[model samples]
Target: MVCRSVLLRSVAAAVLVASVSACSLWGGRAAKPVAAELGPNVAVLGVRQAWTARVGKIELPLELHVNGNVVTLASSDGVVAALDAKTGSDVWRAMLGEPLSTGPGSDGKTAAVVTRANALVALESGREKWRQQLPAQVFTPPLVAGGRVFVLSSDRSVAAYDGATGRRLWTQQRPGEPLVLRQAGVLLALGDTLVVGLSGRMVGMNPNTGVTQWELPLASPRGTNDVERLVELVGRVSRVGDSVCARAFQASVGCVNTARGAVAWTQVASGSEGIHGDDRAVFGTEGNGVVTAWSRVDGSRLWSMDRYKHRKLTAPLLLGRSIVFGDDSGTVHLVSRDDGAPLNRISTDGSGIAAAPAVASDTLVVVSRNGSVYGFRPD
Candidate 1:
């Protein structure tokens, strides 16, 4: 009886979190969570500020892509920038127009950005190379591989374009869901196969021919409510040796074999954001703000930290001896990577973190929701 009661309470809590959604759940469209009180800082954790820059206004949970030593960043205001990873200096900045919805996808040689006008813009060095129109609005960043750019739009289509000339290559699509979240998914190039996340599964494609290689189901839609069925792969993935690790929006987290398209293991964890890892373990935050770590080899639980319950974690990052995470309260927490205990923290701007911090070599790049970008290092 006690076990059943606990299980019922857990399911109820998950439903409550899902119903709140990303936006305003009281009425019309979805909305982001309102700014929460900063509460109290983590006192001290030995994290030192390396540099800070204002890389335009960050309204969405857009992630920063790092290629070479230049990190590509995009803002909702149509501003895209390439910053030096070591110094945090702007290598180049291009203003597209009034509003930019997604991207700043880069593979060092080329960069791609998407606008709110349903367009794909490519840049070389700092110059505009070409721009192409899409059939629908885009919610994820473009994936540049080989000589092609792979884009998954709101119309539930995965299409490829020539990065050099912006010509349409080939397109494959799935049925669009009634409701979708605007979060980005992992789009990576694995040898000859291209991995793109659709509504609830991961589809591997041929970059040259746009052919379906393999389809691996990450999360199946199995909820009674409209909000509960809104599941998709969120954030970026962790590539450990031969395994690809990822998480579903509010479902399970697992690691898959990239070459054979086989499911290794999955644990019932719920998080809207994604995950991060090292050579040994995978770390992610669940919907209730519990940071859990699992072994990369056998998916064994290492430890879990739950002090920040319900704080709305962005994503968990591993930095030196600390497992770092930024919360909706505009504070960054650092916990022991060895034991998962709270260590220290610092505040950005009291507006919450925008996305998972991008790791460039030894430095960590972070952006807050209120347009503040910061660089930090273990001190």
Candidate 2:
């Protein structure tokens, strides 16, 4: 009887392993191997006006900024170029001595660019104002607030420098891996808090002196089993109003109280690649090809759609009453702010859109991966 029982246990274990393997085969849908098919039945708006320019002839055009009639483009070749926002005419160009990891920061009068070697170079109208070297590499764009430029370095140091003179103001260091500031780190001037998204957590710092206010861990503690490993992915944090939202791979979306440092709510999702929010809603895109929207107040899912499935999404761009997002196939989608319903769709010839579209007046400017910049106005 003991031998029979042992054999039966072994058989059950084998069956369980087989079932998991079968599920794994179909699960985790890799981005479709082939380029996505463009739908023929829908009417995509034609390009109203397209402008193409080569700035410094650099590859991997990472970040774009448009302030009034001035546009700045940062490239991997250690150069930042300013152009006319409407005509793409050259305004001025400045070359940093080292390759740039983060994009340019501007206060409409002065522009700050950080390099991989930790140098903060400030420029105005294409002329160098000052340069200062810090102790580590800066992977995140500098934030200009209250006459200071705040920079986050790969060595986990956050420092504030004089925006006009590159003078070091204050520095604070954390214990985790550094984070890249895709959009400028959220500065809540009213709360006196500066929010930064680190590797697996969201950190709140005092805006004035770079003091640690609070730190919130985002991911679950590591587990011993394979199931836990599958769920272990990095968390990304962003600020929407008084709340700081941290999203992790396969983990629940967590909203932390900016002032109290306590978790306000948590909502589960599958992937962490795309998570964005505004004053009204929280948005996330999962590996399963679903984009979901939730209420910012209570963490309730407002609406969901699979139309954006299988395509990588650009970060969500919040317009006045709508959200604009672009996918891998060069399709730009606008969804209603209230119901998440599709409002309009337009296609650009460019393949991959890396940054969120910039809006100036009534015009929307989108930069493609191939260096093609297109401007659109409502018809």
Candidate 3:
């Protein structure tokens, strides 16, 4: 169980989960091994904490919705609050009084939160608007867009509901995998298309009709057993210009030509966390914690940094000229974006950052497992 728990977090870092064993899973392949050692961390980048707002205990990833200067976040205790991005002061707060299964989602208008009890609660202007019971537990954060809220549930289903009325608009489901990730696929909205990362591919769906515009194959299920073929798409997908990049939980990472609905390139590296890239290069942190940079055009390897090898890390985020990511020890590392080189670091709650640090307007925001949300600036 320890090995399963450690390796499941090896790269993907499942949301707010702590225990996993073969007995807990259907007959599946055993997880890959990981060393339980961590190297000494020395601070290089100096960061000053600007402000912090009290959020109740949070175990799952912190879902942050940043629109202009307003940032919204939800705690596991079901308190959703909107804060002033620059000041980190609470502008409004709403409590659902339920154990949150997923985090908060909003469009700077209607805010959404899900309960482990399989309920969806919507709030407007810090007031309860509506609540809807679902068929299964939600695994991904609610995505509010197009007058609808989108969420992926534990039963391999995707559903849309009216953001205002909690009315189910449409529901779609794919066949369940023999072995699937405990986490749900990430969802993105571009125009009228809802781009979703699924079991083994990425699909662009029509938000209005639930029809897929196109599907891009990311990985094919393979293995002697179920666990070997658990090819869930793990985290958020990156979109720069007309290209969209995604990583398969234990398979590979690659980018696609969104305009042409064609794959640009793929390389053989296993990771669950998605890549961070701009127009020229795409960056990834592998399952072994080795970070690499590749040519976004040709998928040719440019450089690789293994300083954090074997250390559990959260998803990497490219911030300005640096790549910033946090480790299991709650230490944040900054590496040069031009080439992967150690830059600076800072320590937080020491309970770890369960999610990728988000950029809210001019501030970098992180939610620690200890229920502390800090707003900081990187120099």
- Ranking, lDDT, top scorer first: 3, 1, 2
lDDT of every predicted structure (CA atoms): 0.76, 0.61, 0.77
What is candidate 2's CA lDDT for residue 32?
48
lDDT of 1 by residue, 46-88 (tens): 6789988886777644778888777888778978888887888
- To one decimal, what is the Cα RMSD in angstroms of model 2 from the true structure? 10.0
Candidate 3 residue runs with Cα over 4 Å from true position? 1-46
lDDT, candidate 2, at 26? 37
**Candidate 3 structure quality by residue, lDDT tens digits, 5-76:** 533332221232322233334445566456445456544666788988878887764556787888888888
Measured against the true structure, the TM-scores of the candidates, in listed sequence, are 0.87, 0.75, 0.88
Q: How close is candidate 3 to the true structure, as a TM-score?
A: 0.88
What's the true lDDT of residue 212 in model 1?
84
The TM-score, computed over Cα atoms with residue i paired to residue i, of candidate 1 is: 0.87
Candidate 2 off by > 4 Å: 1-38, 41-47, 50-63, 66-71, 83-91, 95-98, 177-191, 220-240, 246-252, 259-261, 272-274, 287-289, 338-341
Q: Give the runs in model 1 whose Cα sits over 4 Å from its true position.
A: 1-45
